[model samples]
Target: MRSSNYDKFPFVPVAAQADACQVGWAAIAGVLQAALAAQPAASGQPVVLAVECYPGTGLRQLRQALTQALQPARCLVAGDLYRPTADIDAMVAGPLTDDPVFGRLNGLTISDFFDAEKLRAAQAELAAAAGELVLVLGTGATLVCPDATVVVYADLARWEIQLRQRRGEIANLGSDNMAEKASLKYKRAFFVDWRAADRLKKQVLPRADYLLDTNDPTAPKLISGADLRAGLAAAVRRPFRVVPFFDPGVWGGQWMREKFDLPDGPANYAWGFDCVPEENSLLLGFGEARVEIPSINLVFAHPRELLGEAVHGRFGTEFPIRFDFLDTVGGGNLSLQVHPLTEYAFDKFGLAYTQDESYYMLDAEPGASVYLGLKEDVDFPAMVADLQLAQADSTAPFPAAKYVNEFPARKHDHFLIPAGTIHCSGANAMVLEISATPYIFTFKLWDWDRLGLDGRPRPIHLAHGAANIQPGRTTAWVEQQLVNQIQPVASGEGWREERTGLHEREFIETRRHWFTGLVPHHTNGGVQVLNLVQGAEAIVESPSGDFEPYVVHYAETFIVPAGVGAYTIRPHGPALGTECATMKAYVRT
Candidate 1:
């Protein structure tokens, strides 16, 4: 019902002037041409330009643009050096397994994709092109010409890659399956393509001459690699936000579409990825131009500073905490599901940890409810049989209400869901999902007999869900352990803090603050993610003026890196004198 103040493209201002970034093909090409001209061919050999791209980056468009501008004597697509698509399909079949939604993590690198003979031949071809400009480009261009005169690393965000996959505009690396189902393509990218591509990107980004932002194929942006690094370094020193993306789902709702002022296209918006670094983008501002890069790059490049010593030591370069929105307002119920326990996750999926989560109800309708745990004294075997029968027959919907405990949900109610607990949020509720960031391991047991947007039955992993479901998590246990486990922790003159769980078994801890005045906060040597759950606007300020005051709007999530040390928040703008609330999550340690 409120006007949308949600910022769609949040960027960290990196430079005082705009000259560091070049926008559009003409501007970007001009910068590259100047760099090429400055560094002439050595020993009368060709000036080799290497455009190493992240998979799903539009290489064809990049080649055409740069070719027209630079007039390269020869341009080699890295795919030509790759083994046949059939061979790659066979090579990845084991890791990609036949699963529609899950796969083993691939250990392959970009080098493994190339044919040894073809690579050597390409090397020779580049060497023989004396006195002529040669361009080698694709996902493994740097590997093809390691000693190139200039290197451009084209980077695209994971969400953008997924959109491209959904549109059938791109395919996984070293494969010719552009027409594959988006979900299957996403599985391949998650388990195979991205893993291999990330290995190469880590090596190339730190030393590449330029960083290309290719999220928008029509208008690419270019910045020096040094500027990109500087932007990342600047980010960790302050409270910043990753660019959030919204996606529709089978049980999506209209809350976000109306509240976020999203265009009317998708039927509804289900997810708002507010702080998922692995799947979000971060924009770096250079005066007039903004360059988009995968938010994970910041986590990779500055884990110690951004995550703090303790968190970095535990998670390495990974950002373990995630904050996202799940809106089912004016929609249908979420699928009944369970996440794997830690041991099972590692044994089966190579995950070091599991997805232990908590759902904080941000808004709810009069009868909003959440399905959690199980019904007391329910027939366990009969429930499983019912689930199996439902899976087997489309017309028979699993009787969820008969076996699951439905708890009334209200605004600010936090429900703890440790791994192995059966749970789902009922429709007409907006949820702020805070969790450990192994997000894709969900095992759905039922989907209300609904078909997906692609007009096919959604995949159900009854065996996986049943194996992980804890039968002992019944009504009484859930009442005592999960529902609204809130305890008053501390208070100030105009503010009070309460510990809103995450069960003891979970690594993440959450807290809620109700304030009408300044509320002091510290990272305590670990990264903290927070959202202004109940306010029109609030200003986050550094106690020592280390960083500028950052303004966050209602339902907007932001991160305070451990490096930020101390900060304070207070209602600002329209919420200046009104009581406001914030929910914060961090690693338990």
Candidate 2:
């Protein structure tokens, strides 16, 4: 499950509300009628309906639908009860927390931005009215109206919000420079909304009479008499894909844009949240209607079903693995960073797992290099001092290259980066990062004195990084330990498999294969994540007719559930080759 701190949108087609008002309203109508009847109108009390929602959830349409669906009931916008925008701005500008990683946690939440007392007063006044009352609010509405006859929580996935932000549907919430900034510039607003969602899930969602998945502008999925856990469990049973989200950065690259045919965003597209469920959104399809859900909900709902028995027993609902992309093609280098040890992350950040990542070089420019470990003979204290001086002044005491080691990067090269190792992907490289589920624990030590794309100095955690640095991880150690130990494992007439990442310390293991015909794959009671890394396209099928065969395109990520134990992969394309390379990762035995 996602940690508490990791509290980590739409269009106008036919309003599903039209049909809903005529047909689906009967179910909701019956529930509301009962609740109202239970509390006699003779007591001079009105039915209070609370609608709490994430931003960009299209409250206007829902309000209109509810007005018609519940005759004689008044749907009112309760924005008047919220705290002033000036107050919110002041709260955001206040001092930050000591730990910069999880920044200031208090003032950035919805609780700090909304006035509960004012909302309660409004609720009281509305409850005293002659007819039923519906309160449409963005924050703090649920907490304030505990006596509401009916509560509805409107939500959208994170990727959907990013898409809405890109389409100018959502307003920028950070600094003025955010106009030129990537979607990440809205970090403050994202976290605030995240905390709000977390609160709703933990506090109000179970009691909420209805949950609206407002991802589709035309058709939203409204679950009446909601049960979040049961809904999430059902969602995991089906093979679903989280919408891939992309962002621009100071070191953003063009490989993703060219390969995925992505739209132009901020200069170039750098990172792709292909399968980072912690920050990605799940797409639930029901015929023509689509609902967006936070991907982590599945982990919390079905730990054993999704992660297998042993893995679930070990990690306890943690996804345990993540897949993402890092593009440096025609861009700058990533910051030199190190992730904390497992104990450090758990103790300091409250994370369940630490990030132990590997870079599978999908593509690399000639002479491209990766910075790994440290130089052979360098002073540890001197290197630390140099980093500190560089962070304070604009210049380093000594050249960075003098202290860091760089190795030539090539296509299909895999470099293991366990915790406590310093590493960075240099420019002109497109990397596929397959790693542990903890993706946000990166502690940057150096950024080449460059500012972020948002015009702010990127944070450097020198002290935290220095404390965890393995100084003995010099060039020789990297050559011996970081380099992949590739060995041919199995072979057949027209197929062969090579184990590329079975490092003793890593939980997730990888295997690559080149085959011309079909290659059968078994899940071994553990979930498997694979990508058609080199092939143009491939068809994944179940030999026993267990599930539908899905076609995955080049660079696309897909999952074979633990229940779907056995499957097969066959390449299909006009451009034929003797073999195609496919990479697979799963929990080790």
Candidate 3:
């Protein structure tokens, strides 16, 4: 592989004073203490501070630190105001459906978890504390003391939360199922907790006095709310990248470990989350301090500017496109799976769109191939029966070759896979997966007779797969419609552009540009996601000098917000004299 230049901790530099952010517990405590002291005494009433936290933050440790430093007269945990655990379980039972991997989205808010009487009593108790320092902290602390003298929002990234869940370090909101299966916990959080938390976050973050980065328990970072907002605003006006995370899986490979210089710990790495805003973190640089927050915060804070008006109107504060990596090189194949159709997704999971995806082969071994569609003249019922038998008995391996067609894969090959299409990348291939944002709706039909990393059989959804599978998508239809449908669209001096197939059924349009000179690009009133697929390095700059020059390396994905109207890219550094290529994806207007 070319010398790896992948940046793991990509941060956007924000214009802020040298001391705008504070690092470590000592500095953060000093800042908070100073802010509290500055507040004028209120008619002999106690100074109240509200530390509102996102679910999954280390609340116990946070409270311990603050309590020791501030010596509050009264410290109220907002979780105490929640209704009984049994009542909360029953209340969320409908949204947290029986399915292990899927649940229906609900409209439950954070307030729904609290008992009205308990909330009122807590509010009254905080008001009664006179001539003392009072601190209210927890997931719903803001609800208890909305008019506090100081509000600190302790936030955690969703990816960190997932890691904590896997380590059994935290539990879902208002629930005591810390020892439950991580998958089940994730399902509950996705359908119930996060939806509720995000709603409150949108309301609280805007008015919060300070923003706290709680991703790291030992070392915390604190910044003023205005500085955080300014960082987010700066991000949307330029091309930037969210911090990418890598994870190992049962069928993982060593491509990321070797190429990205990942530390040797896990057996192998399988998934690289490059640009998933909902699950990734965005690092904002303030002088020397680097603060990490959920990348979705940018989407929520500036939807119209990041995503164009047309996209914002359709997706509504949701990022509709996703770009990630699937590495099977030197490992086993991915689970044979199919995504739910659009209507099936909406009716069952309340998702607005399906995961219509394409696998662009970044690197492939000589004999690499992809399992796609079905073999010609295969019996539909017989295929389902085989999948069911294989899932029921782990010892028996499904005859995938008899039912699924395998196509030869090579570097730069684009394979389009709309929803309801049976597809998976074969072993020894590295794939750049471009798709719509509904990422978790996949229904695994079969796994290659292997237990998961947890030593348990992975869940299979044969019934869901059978219901959504398009029986008519045989080998011939797939060959014509899905395989490497590249067409020349435009050409300029030392540069050429080609339209790559995302299929007519998909909403994302992808274009490949091979250039040896500067190539101009426009967002066309929609957000653009691009990856440098062919070269070691390239620079993205504004044509009208609107934003600073942004550099990207091979296999690195970066986003240009819709507000960035015009930009240009050219080979830079090691790729200065090479014919570099980039693949760009955007919402088809």
Candidate 4:
């Protein structure tokens, strides 16, 4: 999750009393009620919103406090973060999900929230609702609007409950307010003078902390859907969002449109939290730090947190390339995230140019669609002309649809989006992005016909975006086997790619899968990225082996190691999986 050190807005301490808290709170609540009533309405009273624990932690407390503050001034509805799972749809009629508020909170669980288009529609519908303020514990999705917002955060007690992440994170935020004065820029400077803990401090170097030091190898993989859903049910009792930094440049900073009262704020730095984003923090790569996990092979991992100098060494010119996924709440469609021309982005934004990206279906439902590349017979000049026309006239229809390939995708399907390819992961679907780092230059050719709740037609940048599209490309193949195949690999063992240059970069390689009864995976000498595409299976001899089968999700991924040596996967439930690929990429830079 993106760490926040900024002070909570509009809430003054008791010492300051009713003055700071009452004025803005009252007026804001009234304005929100008026906005919700003006937008859309549901059959249920003021839309239903629920949370897990009302006052479990600072995050929960903040949410409950926000909800209460708003309700006295308006009639919006809310409940605890957790309300058990409900079959309310069958219980209620008139389109059971007619409430826009529920749309905001849909993806909190497995439901159809992951379906991009449906998600967009639901969000749009809720936009018309009375607004909402809700939070789902454990997950990191937070929805804030003129009406209300639902927040999900990690309880200070748990370590890995939250899913959202910023590239490199360090320091800690507990009950004490040390984080109140923290900043990403400070970490940059501090990492320079940093030192590691005398002992495991060396393990914090790179892959060591994430891969090696975690635990034993040889673990089971098969996980039931029921178990997958409740994997951390007991571990995550309370979740909270803590934005300690006030720098607006962060992705969430801008999407949420938060403005703090601190000086030298905007000029500092942000996590690049936009839907499609780039993280260029000066501290990301200082030098190179490598690791050798006890059960995993040697690895040079990405240092997401600037723990100190030893970590800084991991980032340097030799290892300059990077990759990550930026998930934004509202920005309409993304900035048609294709790579920029030449070093245009580097020259302009100083952000690297590693935009050659592809989409790995993570979570989606029936008819979940994705708009990628241009269809055949479309003239570049004509397409550009159409884009310009739409953006110029307020009432003009978007001309982008006529030129792209549309697909209603299912989980695990891959769409390769080379650099300069025009595409969007779409509104509703949750996607796993495999791309070169430097997610900075996205040229937005068009955004479907929609407007933010603020009565503003979201901004479009055709001229800027059009400069990046490599015309004549389609959402088509890279290479596919006439009839695909799978082969199991054992740890301490690796299969060779005859074509070495296939993926040549800081982190590059192709993927193939192996699954057989009692299959053996030997990670002979390196760390690998294993993305489960089909059936639920477990890894043998794994640090997390003592636990129950992880029942792999169709698209969820886990990092493995050669040191773990020859683990096994046992399929549970139905027939073992469908075929998929896993990347055992190495850092060539």
Candidate 5:
């Protein structure tokens, strides 16, 4: 019920003391009434007043506030008009208009209003002396009386203060806005197959010597020797998956692979390197972890320095492309499995297929054959059905599928198993391990009932394999000079040679170094992924990148990032097959 000072001398106007008001309505009702009170009761000329007030929240207050102001006994003149000019002069003072807010002066929260028109009419009908008058009350509305008095009420100041305070949080003297980061990087690796591990270890693997720690007998085995041992879960009963970035000590939150439905097996399967208090780590697996006996580290990781910021959203740190490891173990005497092409991959996954893969011969018994392509006069449909029957039941007695090209695979031999090429590391006994980042969009054409560890029948992709199969070519093209050019590189004893290839994104160069004294050295650019073919009890260097050599056996995959470019390899004497030590290296291009 605050009020504006009343300045009057005539009619001894019982000073129109008013009730409490919101900052706005009080000014409107008070000023209008005061102007009418000052009017000459006998004069027909009504005093006009343009009234205004500061508007806050007082819609409900305005109705009751004005009603009493126009009481029959309390009013000499009433104040019930928004602009005083017009129909207001003819209406009852109770309320000049039915439209809520009384000409928009009050709001929807109205409780009551008095008729100033009623009083004005009463005065006129009773022949009471009173002039035609004008009254106005509004938010931010101003008024001018015949007496030359001007009244104004407005509130543009308070709101500005509230708005400014909210905008000052980003990089201000008081607080930080916490902008979100959009880009990320991490260290990663992938590999499979005993031979690939063999070819990888003696050669490029020595560079990642930082990952080996053979003396720790407790470490798990990659390619279980003649005596198979199980860990964590019973042999093959539980799902086994990739080991996340291994932390020699901590229990939970170690490897990235555990992030998905993948199962955890023995830590020694495929050991990866990671530091303590990890900034960020992610392990992803597509299906039940596919085993890569004698492994290769598929580096799907980023250097730690880059994973510095906190990841906020789910699926926030997604890889631009799929990261999958394909294994072609025990060449099934036929080239059968196949994957979709780039055009197909893009249509399905919204990106170009990046699974450029390569295979390393782990062990090729005499007369070992590799079907790199389909031979001339081969029929796609005939092959598809035969493959389906054989895969559904290894004893289906399918005929020998014609080979477009075959290569004599010896130990440590390597070949580019790029997309679209219908290739298979042939049987007699050879482990063709694969390395590629693209997820498998496979249509399994044949599985030979391969008898997964679970004893369940393996699935086949008859349609997809037949779709991508390229038939009608030479029977021995892999031995051609052009094809031989793409092989793995070797530099060690016992390992006859190194084969190599200029693979697309999924692969780079493969190093086939027959073991000697593999001293760890810095590999330029990205992580150096390693797979051990044979050997055990090897000495792995400490963080300083310096250590004494130790012994190690075959069939192990090691992942090492650019950071720990330090380590030394000391192979067990010849008695432990020193000449047999060998490995290959894969890096991001």
Candidate 6:
């Protein structure tokens, strides 16, 4: 495995001396016991404690631990108090709907899945009890347990949850059975619950008095209120980096293995969410205990500091920029897809903005290409018919080149793809996809008639994609607007700056640089994401001498906080006059 530099970053915490999963059950129990003891029953009233966590948190094991730790307390399993499973089925039993850009399915809010009134009444009854009462429930309980004396939020890394789910340890919202399906109706319900969980985590985590990182059920890590507050405050004050999440896909590639120093697995590393806080996990180590929470929790806690005053004002708590990898080297092509427009995305998906992305080619084998836009004078209806027919039969080959435009991609080549534009990255290419933070709005129209890794046909949004596609984005128009538009803007001793405004919608702006010595750069009151595209490594420092310099490796992505207005990039081991290339993206002013 490649050496982990995660500890060197300011945001990522060092590993605890405890187990690999960073669980400390003894410490957790001690903290809970102290809290229970501190809040003695007053005037014959009970002390109610609620442990709110997500699904698949090893509740059975946690219940045993909490019972042993909090002796003489009445432990109430929240599952028994949950509303009937019939209610969850009824809420999502509706048929799947589709918009102009994608299929739609609404997830149950806390109210839809659980009985709020019953939970509130139960907590109220428990609060009135003469003895201690503990309620172990999912995150929704935090909002309902207003009468509880203590509330704690339990969190697990998403990858851990997926692993448990695959092992048949966790089930659907109300059933012990996995709701695995390739159909849109089933997937939409899944998306709804997933999105709702994220929403709850974003809103509830900061208010939590104690945060539990239950990555390992046996030894959950606990973070006190003071330590949690301090860690969050420190992150907002400077440029922050979180631990990236990696996953394998059917069209997964091999470049990530060596480039990212990932360990060998059964399948190749397809995607790396380098800077996508939405799905990534953040580690917070306090002394010997390490806690991990969803990275988006940090953004929700300090939107202004992390996203800047202007950015926070416009986008609210949403992180405006994201950097991820789409490695197709030694793999197959990505699905031909488009994203919803700004308005469409908000109406159908509850996202503030649509996904306007660009593919910054990190490396590409000879003859590799990207399918972009549409061919001129295309028969739109006929093309739609062909795609529909292809989706019906797995053996039918998709005539991608017949409808969509194809462009040759080379190393460092950047291709702009605004929403409503059909696009896909071809094989033998490593693409660093930089875009708005809304990463899940992809409206796939075709996938080369291939099944997903699950051995099921991938769902295609043909009607939605057809309705939203920009037919005006013809091959010729894209040649001028989307293709490489590199223009030299500045130069110094051995360095020069070039503007590459690949974001056609101007949601964000990107620039590439060739530098050896110190090249001055500024955040300009907005967060900036930089990637060392060409050289082996470089260091980013504040010219004002405010913070410690950050060393970044090749193909490694890092952020420059809005607070650090001015900084410099100095390439390592570069000969004088030799250029080291780096790409930077920031919200457009």
When summed lDDT is taken over every stretch of 10 residues in candidate 3, the lowest stretch is 40-49
**lDDT at position 307, candidate 2:** 78
| Lowest lDDT 10-residue stretch of candidate 4 | 277-286
Q: For candidate 2, give the lDDT of residue 489.
A: 93
On a 0 to 100 scale, what is the lDDT of residue 256 in model 5?
25
Off by over 4 Å in 3: 1-3
Candidate 6 displacement at residue 412 in angstroms: 0.5
Which residue pairs of candidate 2 clash?
1-317
Candidate 3 C-alpha lDDT tens digits along 1-589: 4446899999999955658888888898999999999995488677888999999989888999999988998999999999999999999999887888888888999999999999999888887887678999998899998888899999999988998999999888999999998988888888888999999999999888899999988889999999989999999999999999999989889888888889889999999999999989999998777899999999999999999999999999899999999999999899999999999999988888999999999999888899999989999999999998888876778999999999999999999999999989999999999999986899999989988999998889988999999999999999999999999999999899999978999999999999999999999999999999999999999988899899999999999999999899999999998999999999998
Greater-lDDT candidate between 1 and 5: 1
Cα lDDT of all candidates, in order?
0.92, 0.69, 0.93, 0.34, 0.35, 0.74
For model 6, residues 334-410, the per-residue Cα lDDT tens digits are 99998888887777666668889999999999988999999999998888888888888767767888999889999
Error of 4 at 298 (Å): 14
Predict model 3's lDDT versus the native. 0.93
Predicted candidate 1 versus true structure: per-residue lDDT over 1-589, tens digit per residue: 4569989888899997898998899999899889989999988588999999999988888889989998999999998999999989999999878878888775899898999999999999998998789988999999999999999999999998998998999988888898988888999999988899988888888898999999998788899989999999999999999999998999999888888898888999999999999999999999978989999999888888899999999998889999999999999999999999999998888889999999999899889999999989988899999999999987888989899999999999999999999999999999999999987999999999899888888899999899999999999999999999999999998899999898999999999999999999999999999999999999999989999999999999999999898899999999988999999999978
What's the C-alpha lDDT at position 580 in model 3? 97
For candidate 3, give the lDDT of residue 53. 93
Q: Measured by TM-score, how close is model 6 to the native structure?
A: 0.90
Error of 2 at 2 (Å): 38
Query: Mind sharing the TM-score for model 1?
Result: 0.98
Runs in model 4 lying further than 4 Å from the true structure: 1-337, 363-366, 426-430, 453-459, 474-507, 514-527, 540-555, 561-589
Q: Where does model 2 exceed 4 Å of error?
A: 1-48, 55-101, 104-151, 160-196, 202-211, 215-235, 573-578
Screening candidate 3 with a backbone cut-off below 3 angstroms (N, C-alpha, C), the clashing residue pairs are none
Clashes of each: 0, 1, 0, 89, 89, 2
